[model samples]
Target: MNKYFLKTTLALTIGFSSLGMLPGTSQPIEVEAATTNTQNNNQAVAAKADQLIQTGKSLIGKSTYSNTVYKPTAPYKFSCATFLMYIFEKNGVDLATYNENYMIQQGTYVTRNQLQKGDLLFFKSKKTGTDPDHVGMYIGNNKMIHMADSKQNIVISDLNSKPYYTENYVSARRVLPTLMSANPATKGDKIVQNAYDLKNKVKISTTNNEKYLRFTAPGFVEYVYQKSGVNLGTTNLKAQMNLGKTVSRANLKKGDLVFFNSVKGSKTPSLVAIYAGNHRLIIPNSDGVITRVLLVDYYNEHYITAKRVF
Candidate 1:
């Protein structure tokens, strides 16, 4: 619908072996639920980029394209690069210029393969050159959103959807680490905020007929984090432990993922909890109830690691 960004299906086509392809649709690429990202930094970067994209998407219907006016607030008007610049500025990054030439020339150069969410993608306008004149923000699923031109409104386009972009695409730049530094509410903060809000809301799934509680420890953590926009992918315990920045037990934060070696059953780190701060953690107990437990001797003796995945 017109409510969300990218109302129309882009005419993009590519071998989405990495990203998943909908059963019948070849042009529409879906987020690969199977192609899991293991690196915590990538997850954090993707989360931040997705958040920025969602925020920018909220402005789609309200803005228009203009080369002369580069305002991003009310009655927003901007050219392709200016539009992207204004969006980044709104998201706490000041790129310092609305020009695409400098836009492509500066920032950390991201290879086509290493592109992450929130990366600035620049492309040639008329012909290939040293610097591109058009730009867009790379959202996940190989899609990017930008101000097309004066005749077109802001829209989402698949990187492979249009020949122009595929052929003219020059480079990408990342500014998330810098942005995260400037913003106090880090990804971990957002992740924990979502967890606390869902503490009471998360319930045992009624559909699954498993004998144990509605969710396994890893399943619960994945669900809570996923709802907050970080896809923890698989529900396997080892996989969950593999996510996020590993931290020492001494450096645990509010949202750090705490893993405990199996004291009763399962393998090492059989238990997991969401750090609730003040030396406390909330977990789904075997009694099928969510409760707060302290980092006592029992937990410390079996403690594994605290992961920071935002």
Candidate 2:
């Protein structure tokens, strides 16, 4: 047959003969053949691993790695860890046993050097030792994929590149299957098109008043009331409240006033407003004034459920 198979067969025949197991009998030869088959199977597994790594890289910004606890669309969206789950799943690996939180916990407790292609990566405010605030997938070669904070979008980043990732570098864990049967690759255009298509299928609206402006989603509305002038609490209030509603739900235009609230346990509110895609939202919270977060940030497990109030 193939050269690899022939070589493996020859190697096994010699090994069995040396052990005195292969007498001048047909049965001994049959045993050697079976042993060769097992070696070939192991080699095939190694090849599959390499192929899966390449597949993961191709899916970089296109596939969703994290689960959308509140997905308004199908095929679903992913976060870092969830995206890794998808990659592993596509390759025939099963990880239904672990959820996002479980994966994050494992990543934080594990060491960096132990990371592999399908492991999880996490990040957070360097000043605060709180929960792993952000998550991503470990795709080997010191690189990771994440739906980065509001500004970055879904992307691949160098593990040691950004100051936050370098200094606050957490942990990584390997949980993918040892072998995958099929591999599918993704491209950037397909990802953008998918996101755009989803956005178009949904309904979005915007409204304005002399003092306040707002955008509406399927079930939620975000409003921004003018502040006499920008202040710390007022700034953060503007951002955290209407972060997602504008771009995602209302398709906001320039010069809009985004609003925020200072309610405790309500670090982030259900609705927010926007001034243009460029003007960032700001609000006062336990951690002081925070600004410039995406609308999806309101859906972070840490924040309250988002509702439209246009």
Query: How accurate locally, in lDDT, is each candidate?
Result: 0.60, 0.37
For model 1, residues 1-310, the per-residue Cα lDDT tens digits are 0011311111011111222224553232334322212233656567656655765676576678766544544566667766665455444333534556655644578888888788888887665346576788888788888888766678999888879888888788766653233134556656655554454444545332224325665777777777678887878878888887998877877678888886644347767887754454666544332433343447767777788876
Report the number of clashing residue pairs per model. Answer: 2, 32
Judge candidate 1 at residue 283 and give its lDDT.
66
TM, every model: 0.44, 0.36
Per-prediction CA RMSD (Å)? 17.0, 22.9
Model 1 is weakest, by summed lDDT over 10 consecutive residues, at: 7-16
**Measured by TM-score, how close is model 2 to the native structure?**
0.36
Candidate 2: regions farther than 4 A off:
1-55, 60-76, 97-99, 105-110, 126-130, 176-310
Best by TM-score: 1
Tens-digit per-residue lDDT, 1-310, candidate 2:
0001112111111111101123443221112111111233446444434444544455433333333331212333444444444444334333321234444532124578766655667665547545555667666688876666434546778987878888766566543322222123112122212222222222333332323222232111122221212122323333434433433225433323344333536555544433212222333222222222333333233333332222
